[model samples]
Target: MRESEYAESRADFVHQLRIAIKEANETQYWLELLHQADYINKKVLNQLIKTVLKS
Candidate 1:
C-alpha cells in the first residue's frame, strides 16, 4: 500500500477508536447512575414501608 493510503487508514482507525472510547465511557456513566438511582429507590421504599407499618 502507498504511504498516503496508510496514513489515511491510520487516521480512520484513530477516529473510530476515539468514538468507541466515548461510547464506552458514556455507557459506564449511565450504568453507574442507574445503580445509584436503584439504591436510592430501594431505600425510599423501605422507609415508606416502615412508616406505613407504624401508622
Candidate 2:
C-alpha cells in the first residue's frame, strides 16, 4: 500500500493499484482454500474475509 505513496507518475500509481488488487484476490483465494480444507474456523474465516474485503 505504501508503494503507491511515492509513485512518481500516474502510470506507477495505476500499476501499484493493479498489483494490490491482484494480491488481495490471491489472499481471498487462499483464505477460502483454508476454510474449505477445515484448517480455519468459521469465526476466524469470517473475520479475515471481512477484513480483506473491507480493505
Error of 1 at 45 (Å): 21
lDDT of 1 by residue, 1-55 (tens): 1223344577876776666566656655555565577854655655654553343
Tell me the whole-model lDDT of each prediction, alpha carbons only: 0.55, 0.90
Query: Which run of 10 residues does model 2 get worst, by summed lDDT?
Result: 1-10
Badly placed stretches (over 4 Å) of model 2 are none
**Clash count of each predicted structure:** 0, 0
Q: Give per-residue CA lDDT, model 2, range 1-55, as digits (tens).
A: 6798889999999999889889889998999899999999889889998998787
Stretches of candidate 1 off by over 4 Å are: 1-8, 39-55
TM-score of 2: 0.86
